[model samples]
Target: MIGPTMTPEILARITAARAARDLSDLARQAVGTTAETISPAERIKRARRMRQMVNAYLDTVVVAEALAGADWSEITEALGRREPDTVEGEYADAVAEWSDAAEAEADAAADVEELDAWYARHREDHDPDLEKPVADLLNRH
Candidate 1:
């Protein structure tokens, strides 16, 4: 079945994530003391770098799982279930921004006019008066 393919860089991402996953120990070394001993500045510096590692770990795991033939719709559903709790307005704004970026990326990557025209023609053949515009390029949660 057609689905998302792993990019060439995915292997590198996997490797980097593997390394990043173990950085807590290295971070301990760099800090050279317990959290209580460190100045607030040092703590924040460690926090920022560790945050990147966590992000990499999450990104690689999700992308690797999806590329390894997992059901993408299921993955999406799982991710949605894991979304952070947020205020109503924050959630709405995030959704809107996600929607806008998705549409923008699709438009950037393809000839929108020709693509929509193709969709129109195909749908017309399949269902005469029921023809409609193509659905969103990237499915958003």
Candidate 2:
């Protein structure tokens, strides 16, 4: 019998498949790294970049997976089991570490904005140029 076609479900499945493939490739690369020309720091930088790439790829993958109506737990479970701790766990921890630093930077930026706005309101208007331009336009008004 011909099966019914579901667009969202099909699309999500495709997205998940692509995400899994990308994650798998990354895991393979991470595992394959050994004592070679590249140092740990370099490897980590490369790994971080790869993780970012995978995360970007997952942005689409996640949306598509949601549209497909797949269970979140199932997806996570599948990824967890397939990826293993060494790959997925390490990558996740590294991303989390970076995310924490980024959040702190964002908080500092917000504080700076608040301070700037406060100072802008309290600061005296000390600009003769502001009047000069107007004075030049209206010489006898």
Candidate 3:
């Protein structure tokens, strides 16, 4: 049968992001939906699940890059060449920028129903039958 095909890098990033988001959602639910919903048992379970998901995602990233023979040394060295203090300051600025952008995104994300619909549409559009078995295997937890 014909299978789904995508660039390795794109697939890796999407898989990583989805897994990260799923872990975040579970952690959020576990810690407490609000100020009052925290249950020790639920929190423990959520923490375990989040850790497992994170490890799995990291493993996926490692394997994906290994398969591609991606060498990160050059990238790392280039990034490391910046003065440590300068890097730290830039990192802090980037964090602030990201936070501001995230806050701005709150308004854009106000339409939860529309967002759900959009997600469904995109998921279907990107559906790859070829990777179904592999995806199913990894998602079995």
Whole-model Cα lDDT per candidate?
Answer: 0.45, 0.46, 0.47
Candidate scoring better on lDDT of 1 and 3: 3
Which regions of candidate 3 are displaced past 4 Å? 1-5, 34-39, 71-141
Q: Residue 27 CA error for candidate 3 (Å)? A: 3.3
lDDT at residue 49 of model 3 (Cα atoms): 73
Give per-residue CA lDDT, model 1, range 2-82, as digits (tens).
Answer: 123323223323333335435645575666666377689977797797778776666555554544445555656666744
The true-versus-predicted C-alpha distance at residue 108 of model 2, in Å, is 44
The local distance difference test score of model 3 is: 0.47
Query: Rank order by lDDT, top first?
Result: 3, 2, 1
- For each candidate, what TM-score against the reference? 0.40, 0.37, 0.40
**Candidate 1: lDDT over CA atoms?**
0.45
Estimate, for each residue in 36-111, the C-alpha lDDT of model 3 and write its tens digit: 6668886677668778898777655543443344544432344555364553443444334433343333332233
The digit string of per-residue lDDT tens for model 2 on 1-141 reads 112322433333333444555566677677787655787789889889787877766655544444444555555665654544443443444344433343343333334333334334434567232322211222321
lDDT of 2 at 138: 23
Which scores greater on TM-score, model 2 or model 3? 3
Between the candidate structures 2 and 3, which one is better when assessed by lDDT?
A: 3
